[model samples]
Target chain A: MTLNPNRAAGATPLVAMKDISISFGGIRAVDHVSIDLHAGEVVGLLGHNGAGKSTLIKCLSGAYRMDSGEILIDGEKAEIHNPRDARRYNIETIYQTLALADNLDAASNLFLGRELVTPLGFVDDSRMEAETRRIMGRLNPNFRKFKVPVAALSGGQRQSVAIARAVYFNARILIMDEPTAALGPQETRMVGELIQELKRQGLGIFLISHDIHDVMDLCDRISVMKNGVLVGSEQVGDVTEDEILGMIILGKKPERAGVN
Target chain B: MSDTAEAHGAARKRSFIETLEIDTRLLGMIGAFIVLCLVFHFQTDGRFLTPRNIFTLAIQTVSVAIMATGMVFVIVTRHIDLSVGSLLALCSAVMGMMQVVVMPQMMGMGFGHPLIAPLAILSGVVVGVLIGAFNGWLIGYLTIPSFIVTLGGLLIWRNVAWYLTSGQTIGPLDPTFQLFGGINGTIGPFWSWVVGGLGTAAALWSLWSARRAKQVHGFRVKPAWAELVMGGLVAAAILGFVAIVNAYEVPAARLRRLFEARGETMPEGYTTGYGLPVSVLVLIAVAIAMTVIAKRTRFGRYIFATGGNPDAAELSGINTRLLTVKIFALLGGLCALSAVVASARLTNHANDIGTLDELRVIAAAVIGGTALSGGMGTIYGAILGAIIMQSLQSGMAMVGVDAPFQNIVVGSVLVLAVLIDIIYRKRTGGFK
Candidate 1:
């Protein structure tokens, strides 16, 4: 395992994962991987399919139990053993499919797991609806509320609802998996803007994307991986698409090694 | 503006295929209703629409409709309760046996007096709730598929009912017990009109309030006029039904007339308005209550969420197992209640009571737009579905269709309903 770079100037890392290793059937999927994310920073996790990027994130999200690792949130050591534990640490994940129930509209989805109840012992739908409108007004102004089922909503609107569900629950760390996958250019941009807004709210985002362009445009830091190993983490402004591609192809970061 | 208007007009003129593609269940239900009307219209020389037959129709639909109300909840959570029929039979048999055994014992103990009927109802409810809880625990906490659990329960509970009754009919219930199955005294249909009118008004008010809240919040709201139109149609249907029912004698009155052949005349002009059958009122209340709970409560919302996508619901932190158990328990309790009403009406709780009703209850829910795959259905729709089934049975019988033929007709109707549901789903892109 290689050492992480020093924090630049006054910017402290919001999260530092050190010596993370996980295996399946004695085969290392994430072998001694280490990464850091800063407050209000968008860090892109980039690798080819099956290059262990997802496995590493799943470990961080408590979807997979890590064999060995030390995770620090805001420089404090933390253990996340399950999704509930992750939630307690204010970590939220929005899967690529959005996972919103199509039959329930935005308000219902916004409060899907934790609904506001009235004093009368029923679901305070009115309160939920009002809260949904308020949150959506800040998140995605174009969202519609009158729809009985969300099946009628556009894909971007659906994603907005899913993101709003996580954000409304006070998530400090947002993990988005291919947020713009399968979306049109307009919807993609819409999600990109939403992600930026979340960043402005001071959330540290771990964005997993296959599109190198998306990473270059939206991410502040890019971490490249190959074959269950971390190649290098570079500032997006300092790295090129081809350089990252080389790291993915050669299983070693040439630029970091001063060999490029 | 003109171009936009023209585009909108073009969209409106899209093919029926497109409409079917958008709302498969709607088309399927409408199509089924049309087919049923056509068949009944052709069969009894149009007597199916007569007041007497319609009165009979309400009575025939009550028990199934009531049970279907709860079955909607069970089905919505992607579960089935086969023990519902058995539960009903057990409740009725217990109630019947209690009249002979438990009630006399109470009288002997000097604790009953006039409390026997109330005690009987209480016992029925407690038994139902306990059975429901047991079923829920088995399916939800034990991680058994509901079908297997309820199927085993269905056989076991029916055997219990038979064993309790010694495989004989238990009957001659207290007159107060029979009151549940009898019609309330008639008020020339005025009471039905008043109650139905109030119900419609309440519905309209809630719809208006919901829309108002949406508009005030600048949320994309359903059009006010559209809801008003739909509510108006429903209100009109209720008013029309009241008028039709008010014009006819309740089934209880008819039964009384048959009893009058032995020189006993029913009280002059006895009527229960359109509220003739207490079971009908029970069915309506159950339907409304379940609908409100499913559409308006957090737990109800969870039921749909769990049914539609269990993984997501679980991720959201819902106790999905607990919800399943609660829903199954509700179904069991409701089935027991239905059994009491129905058995009392029959004047006996036979070991064979509630037999084959499970198929009808499930069939009604499935036909009423409940998805076998879960996360889609309504209690109101289930009631409508039950009505369609009951109408077919009653209309065929009115035209002299024998029991064997009636079974064939019903079986075919159930199959047709499923076929229509499938076709509707395919047309509407329910499955991708």
Candidate 2:
């Protein structure tokens, strides 16, 4: 797939993490990793299991505290002590498990923490349902089950709920960890379309997955990490699937023109 | 074209069946309650349906039902309160000692002083809250498992209650204080009708407003006739209860009738209706408040979320530990209220009061469809469950069943209810 790099050469990156490091029980899980994301772009993080890709992204999502790192949003230092702080900075994450309450309906799950309430301080279900419908219409027009609990929904519909929640909250930077891991091919295509729509709206996304084909098909730039270190970052148009695979398994950068 | 039409019709029919099958456990409870009533009515030669009998049954259900409403929240958040029965005993002991022994002696006033009643109740509830806060802190902030903490509480609180009275029964409560628990202290017939009518109106208004909101939002809603039928059913149930209570004549009028039958003159101005019992009204108010909390409040939603998945709830910015503390404290307050009602009804605080009541309260919640595994329940369902349990005990007693057999039957019914709940969830594809 041909790709055009979305980050302008001189424009400030949307987010930058410098020398982020974290350890678990005396083992370095993520060490000295630096990465950046830009608006209107898709950056794919590819690695093997336990390669520290998830741990690294978790720091940005505020699920984990990095041992040493500086995070900058729009070239300005940002402090994220917890998930609430991350949300305040317009950073929403869609974990592989989706983190939804299984027994609550779609609208309830969508507004789980930040519920809409009336003047009487009661949860306004009707208003929340309306908002959910409006957003789902934009993200996935075919989604119709608003009253059923998420446990009753198909995998793709559950994903739609998770995605719609992130997007509806005006998220500027989204981190999706293996969004299409359990989906069928058709659902995977649907997620791809959703990501493309999000990109068109100028939201920067960090797509974390082990699927090389998905990265080639959807990402503007691919960042490969192996054993807690960044192997290399390359524009998709400048690297082949074999070379990316080589970087993932062998932790070796391909000698490609104009690649860093 | 014909095939397509047939397929559409079948799909519509299937959806209708699906809607009917939703919450089958609730439907099962309703069915079981009706069956129990019929059996008791037949077994007692129609005495079970009498206004007098029904009134007593409602009173009997109120104390446990009140606690069950709070239990719904506790169990919904994946916790248990084995200490409620003991808590009730302790609160009642405190109230009795304050009203009957301490307050009168300290103030040099008679026990019948009206001030004594409210003061005793307040102190009782305050003590309950303090104890509950202690329990909440241990389980929530200290990270102790609720099961172990509450199990320990069950033993400790009961011992404290026993120690408070030194195994002596406190009795013959003040007349003014007894009114809260006695039948003669009930509201009159006129006010019962007024309250019932207002309750019906509120129910209808809520239904209509919900429909209007759905329409305004352009969301799919039930058909107009379906809503109308639901409203009518609720109204009938409320009106029927009022009619039953109104049928019971006052004890003074009955005494006057007996005197007249003996060919003697009767006292004038002895006319009155049984009206509604004070405790029953209290239970109704608690039920309404709890239902609203469970269905429409953020705290209620957090309870369910915490039960559904603690990790997700915390990651969503909810403080699950703090929520746990608040829920336990609320349960404690409910326990205090139950103590007030129980003590007032019997006009005494005995060592055996509230014995084994925690088991009954938990059974009622489980029968009402509150899962022990957590994440799903309703306050109304818990109330109905309490009614079902009381009905069984009342029916079996009227039928002259042995006490041990009654225990066996009640235990079996509880196990059967949970088994049915599991099957119903599986049939409906609910999360286990």
Candidate 3:
């Protein structure tokens, strides 16, 4: 199925990844996929494992380079060669594996690359810890073991630290890959509220998930991919949960969802 | 440290040491050190702790200890530089050639020209840094494993050193350079006390300012008395070391020779002590500078972070490849610095200078609690590790133990220290 590759008439998308394709070892992990996100919107990217959902999002997150594609940020071409470049565009990612330095403390992990520094150019560890505490206080008030390395924390605690790192950074565009895979149900709800909060703050988020209910609950639009191809992109109200699942499972296009 | 201890503190009522916020691991190491000293003192008929012997040990540890400080970071990053001993020899040879052969022949600058020693030192350091950068480039850019690259360096640099000197010893170095060797240059008792006072002041001020910073940040601060007591303990340690070193008096015969050389008469009962050797002072400065780098600087942070998780560090925007080059380059500079102290101490550069020193440095860093797997080390720990290694060897020698037997004991001690460190980390729930 040919997905529509058009921009809104007047409003520019906060991020538009156009015609992205990449391969590894003669296998097309992501092939000619295009997606866009607007401010104050949550775009759910749904697929099974090895369905190219992750590979496609990784291009915009700067974890992978597309074979041929260009990323436009707010209608301007953006050059994202690395995670550092992606960060410069105020883009932050919370990977499925969390991508945290396990041996460092919560504050150190949060400020790993861009540390808060004193006037004398030393890492202002105290200020960072305080800020971490302030943010965690709002995210998870029970997070008292701030001083230990994340390696020592429980699964849920570690999840919050990863979440707090992304949330505290004030990212204009956020990418989350299976963020709730390690989180408890309560924590999952907390993240749902966080997504809502970030949405009202006018940030664009790309939430990659397999849970249809979660997508329907949190996302405004859903993009489903199968075998390195985008099968459909549909509004939450315009589609039912089963139709979205069919697109995810059988690579059904949006037009066929209406016919069936 | 405050890192994990605060969480432990919150869990239950704290112990005395925990309340004081002292690292239990460091305290345990210190305890072991003192115990080792006491046993040696008994075996050596009290000779081990005598002022003269203690002073000698301090000077002897300087060369290896300086290199060990750099080795901590190297090991912390899970890389090994097996060429340090060879690098030290090469640096010493370069400095020697600069002083005895190159300076007079090329620059036409004869001995006692002042530029000879300074220029020679600079040349040695440049060679070290350049070679270090080359090694780093191979490991970081060429994607060669550090172990293989440095292992090759161990053999290559040693041969290079031999070729530079043509298997000969260069001697009768610039007289001023010998001062760093300890006997020729000693800051007298007065200056030692002054330095001690300044060190105490710095320690106190640092402690106070840290407390102030904590208060400003609204984090949990330690009790005021705990800070005061810790400060007092550090001050006492610095002052005590100075006092012990100051107790070693210049022999009357040597004093008389000095007076005669100056054409000055020696007065009766006019005695003075060699308070601290300049080499030891240099090690202290290196320790301070390395600690500051490890704790305060972004470069140091990236190193540990990379060691902890290279993927995470890379994703966090750290240029880890460039950092590797810088780390090795820093280590090479330190090796050159060690060469300076070593060659100065020998009063010449020798064929076997710095032989087997790479093992000693790696042993020191590992003993100091730098995990070989990567991502955990401390500068002070490495220095203490060097000290412990030196003390064990020297004490065994004083008790008439054979050289091979001394090596066996030191080797066993290194293994035992790492075993203990691993168990402690496992028990304490530290990073796996």
Q: Please tell me what DockQ candidate 3 reaches.
A: 0.59
lDDT of 2 by residue, B265-316 (tens): 7767666677888888889999999998888999999999888877778778
DockQ of 2: 0.43
Ranking by DockQ: 3, 2, 1
Q: How well does each candidate superpose onto the true structure, as a TM-score?
A: 0.82, 0.92, 0.96
Tens-digit lDDT track for model 3 on B1-432?
A: 464555555677767897797877889889999999999999988999998998999999999999999998888887999999999999999999889888977778877778888888899999999999999999999989999999999999978989999999998788877777876778989999999999999999999999899899877788988988999899999999999888999999999999999999999999999998998898999999999999898998999999898998988889888989999999999999999999999999997999999999999888888899888999998998999999999999999999899988998999999999989998988773
Best by lDDT: 3
* Per-residue alpha-carbon lDDT of candidate 1 for residues B39-124, written as tens digits (9 for 90 to 100): 88787787778776777778767788888988888887888888888889988878877776777764573323477677787788
Ranking according to lDDT, highest score first:
3, 2, 1
Estimate every model's Cα lDDT from 0 to 1. Answer: 0.77, 0.87, 0.88
A1-260, model 3: which lDDT tens digit per residue? 12123324567889999989999999999888898898878889999999999988888878888889899999999999888899999898888787888888889998999999999999999999999999999988988877777888876677778778777888999998987887789878887888888877888899999888888899888888999998878877788878888788888775645311
| Model 3, residue A64: C-alpha shift (Å) | 1.9
Candidate 2, residues A135-156, lDDT tens digits: the string is 9988889777777678877889
TM-score ranking, high to low: 3, 2, 1
Which DockQ values do the candidates obtain, in the order shown? 0.31, 0.43, 0.59
Q: Which clashing pairs does model 3 show?
A: none
